[model samples]
Target: MNFIESELLRIFVGEQEKLHHRPLYELLVSEALERGMAGATVFRGLLSFGLRHKVHTSKIFELAGELPMVIEIVDITEKIEEFLPVVEALLRDSGAQSLVTREAVRQWTT
Candidate 1:
């Protein structure tokens, strides 16, 4: 067994946000893949809100059909740090705002 200290980047976004008419989530994962990162995961939330305090939910009516999306990527510190700016650029290009968090953790490897 082996383990190493890695960085985890968690991005909070909306399902409807798009970049060039494509889903933002798709682009996020694709970028991570292209970067040769260790791994990435996307989680769709049934209910969530951001700094704007606007609530989005799966109730269909509560959020007006919008749900929260979270993209999490884990990799080496250098990789994560390098990718951080890319994420910001995507958000800017899409004209959307999101919350991104990065932290350190132990990553297990085979």
Candidate 2:
């Protein structure tokens, strides 16, 4: 069995101002990858709400507006640790929070 030791970094940030969620997430992932991080991805919640009383969830068919987005990146301990500072700076600049970072013991890949 193959194994990977890494940290799973999950960052939840608000969708506000001119900073679009998808683009921001892509940028973050790209930046991390460029720094030699394993990989990163962004996940958009269909119906979700977050800080600043921003409500992206709605029953109507029409799209409301900005929604909470999560950027997940997994990499080795050294790499993830190196990325933490950068991630923090980005989050601070964007005024976003709810960052959850933890060490992952195993990775199951086919």
In order of appearance, the predictions have TM-scores of: 0.91, 0.74
Task: Evaluate model 1: give its TM-score.
Answer: 0.91
User: What digit string (tens of lDDT, one per residue) describes model 2 on residues 36-106?
Assistant: 87778887766775455555664544544466567888887888888888877766666655556665855
Expressed as tens digits, the lDDT of each residue in 34-105 for candidate 1 is: 999999999999877767778777876757547878999999999998998899899999987788898998
TM-score leader: 1
Q: Lowest-lDDT window of 10 residues in candidate 1?
A: 57-66
* Model 1: residue 2 alpha-carbon error in angstroms: 1.5
Question: Highest lDDT among the candidates is held by which one?
Answer: 1
lDDT score at residue 74, model 1, on the 0-100 scale: 96
